[model samples]
Target: METFNSSKDFLRGINKKVFIAVLSVAILMTTFSAMAIRKDVVLVCDGNEINITTFGGTVESLLNKQGIEIGEEDKVIPELHERVTDGDRIVIHRAFEIQLVDGNEETTIVTSRKTVEEALNSLYIELGQMDKVQPDLQSTLEPGDTIRITRILKETITENQEIPYQTTIKYNDDLDYGKTTRIQEGRSGVKEILLEVTYEDGLEVSREVIEEKIIQEATNEIVEKGTSRYLVTTRGDSRRYKDVIVMEASAYTAGYESTGKTPGDPYYGITRSGTKVRPGVVAVDPRVIPLGTKLYIESMDRTPSYGIASAEDTGGAIRGNKIDLFFESREDALRFGRRKVKVYILD
Candidate 1:
């Protein structure tokens, strides 16, 4: 019976050692499980980085354990209520004030977005086709930055305008010299014009003429200029003249019977203009036809025609339109008698 008791005590001692070993293994396994639940994560906030090993849980609880405070407008990547795993990243951006100007209205906004486009989207601001933005939508943003938006508008309008009439002049010989007569009166016309106008923020930016149409035809003014007279020459050629006259013409010779001066005299038969008397050289009254004036003479009785002549000398009987012609011989002078003739003053 004593040997039996001794064997039982030995068994009890071995069992106690085994129980302590088992408890140690269990404690080690519990510690390893707790270690397995921890994770190495990166925390990015305030333009800085913080690396740490932490227990796995929701992002909100982890941030709270690190003593990080989140505001209502603060942005957190992966969201605060989302679960975190090993090698997870936590990014936090602090909210900042921004000035937003849309057309004529301005307002203040709080946002944590990284770009201008994201911030505008968050604020529910929409853009139109013609709308313009400052600091472009894809640009990076900073605190207190100003964003301006402009609204563009276009309009087309049609207007009626007046077209002025023009004046034209024509020549007429019925009226006297230096006289002007109106043949037609002038009148204005009408036209339609289209214009395009652009405005920005209720202020005009530019205007352009787009189209034009004629609505009424204009009437031209006509004026008559009356001054000159024309004459027909015996040679069938038309010539311009200022006056005409009917004259008594006669013929004489450079002889003692024609002039009181003798033929031997130096001044006898010579004209006042120093020209020798001939068929085309004529004598005239200086008061009637001025000296050095050109003339065309024709016999009214159709006997002969004097194509062109010059008034270079004067005679006592040559007054008004009367003229005297010189012949080379006395017989020729006697043959030609005094008769009415047509005299034209040529230009």
Candidate 2:
């Protein structure tokens, strides 16, 4: 009876140990099943879509599990503490550094906005109609992009300008050739001008003329010029002459010494005007005094006058205000070497 009792006790102890082992295994399987409950979630990050499976939890827990860091300016669609469910979509916009150059100030900004217009609106930066912005307002914002804003201003101003007068000349046949008479005085005018000026960042960029008004009309000056041809001789004699010239005078004879030809040569003792050389003949520059023009010669020094002469010849040495008087004898020609005289041109 004692042996049978010991055998029953040993079998009961083995059965108890087996039951404990099976219960522990059951508990472990249940815990693992609960931990494996995962949900299908879609994450959109910076415009890129991603499919992910995560254990059911809050949005903050999901992001922490994925090792994603959130910034102050970053945007998240769902609240961080919101519980996540199956097939839930989560959107995230990562902020990026951007350079801002507004007028003369430069600064760095971090923004999660999609475009330049949205970014400026969030910052409360206003723009004018005439203002200009670089990278355009509609352009997409990129990482490390530089945005420039140019402030423009316009203003209109008035200015006064002076107008110059004109001078006119009229010819009068009654007055002498060397005389002039003033008929009217000149007066300047006044004009008003309107200008539109443009400035960029407090600096002048350009200016344009908008309107012009003439305040006063200018008066033209008028003067009269003489056209008559007449003069009196220095000898107190009233002589009617077309022109007068002070000329350097010299005398020449119709000999081999002056004419370079003997008396019997083909052109000897003849003048350029188809006349014979005589005492009253004179050589002159044909450009100054036309050949065959009548002239009277008077000496400037206290010497006898050369009397009346005719411009009937031309000489190679006679240029400008120069004259050569013809003489009959070589002795008389040498005696009147050179002198200044006044020659009158008769009409």
Candidate 3:
């Protein structure tokens, strides 16, 4: 009876140990199954779609598990602390950095807006009718892109301008050549000018003349030009002559050294005009001064004048505006040498 009772107790103890082991295994399997619960989610980031199966409970946990980072300017479709469920779609709009140059200010803007127009509107930056925007407003925003805004302004202004006067010249036969007389003084006029000025960012860019009104008419200036020729002599006598010429004067005697002739020749002392050569007789080019023409020769420098002379002789060396005066002696002729003189042809 004692052996049978001990055998029954031993079997009951074995069954109890088996039941406890099975119960512990079942509890561990249930905990593991609960931990292994997963959700099928679709994540859309910056227009890119990703399908993932995650065991995270919230959007934040899911992103943390996927090693994704969020910035202050970044946008998310749902709140980070919101619970996630199966077949849920999560959207993340990544903000991009853009360089903005508005007028004189340069700054950086991070925006999730797709177009430049939307980005500016989001910031409440207004644009004028004449303002210009580079890359256009409808252009898609890109990372690290530069957007420039040029502020255009136009203004009309009035200014006073000077109008130049005209000049009129008249010929006067009484006045001498190279002489001018002013008849009237010129006066500048005044005119008002209207200009449209264009400015870009407070700097002048262009200007256009819109209107002009004359405030005062300009007075024309009158001038008289001289045409007559006259000269005053040393004796304080004013004379009117047909023409005057500057000639190179040279003295010569009736000798072989001057005319290549001696006293023995028939035309030795006689001139081409059939007259004897004297102190007042001079040789000249007939094409310039006709033979027998009377002239008053005055010295141009400090030398004494040649006085009254007659063009009654001709020589091969005397041409153009050149004159050869007759001298009594070879020594006197050599002393005279050559000089420039003004010869006036008398009527």
| All-Cα superposition RMSD per candidate | 13.3, 8.1, 8.3
Compared with the true structure, what per-residue lDDT tens digits does model 2 show for residues 1-347? Answer: 99999999999999999999999999999888766677889998766799989878899899889888788899777878898888899998889999999999999999988899989998899999999999999999999999899999999999999999999999987778768999999999999999999999889999999999999989998999987776454456665566789999999999999989996898999999879899899999999999998888988898888867899999999998999999999999999999999898977
Per-residue alpha-carbon lDDT of candidate 1 for residues 105-199, written as tens digits (9 for 90 to 100):
99999999989899999989999888899999999889999999998888999998999999998887766556789999989899999989998
Of the candidates numbered 2 and 3, which has the greater TM-score value? 3
TM-score of 1: 0.59
Model 1, C-alpha of 256: deviation from truth (Å): 30
Candidate 2 positional error at 139, Å: 3.0
Among the numbered candidates, top TM-score falls to 3
Ranking the candidates on TM-score from highest down gives 3, 2, 1
Estimate, for each residue in 82-148, the C-alpha lDDT of model 3 and write its tens digit: 9888888999878989999999999999998788998899889999999999989999998999889
Cα lDDT for residue 172, candidate 1: 77
Q: Per-residue error at 54 for model 2, in Å? A: 3.6
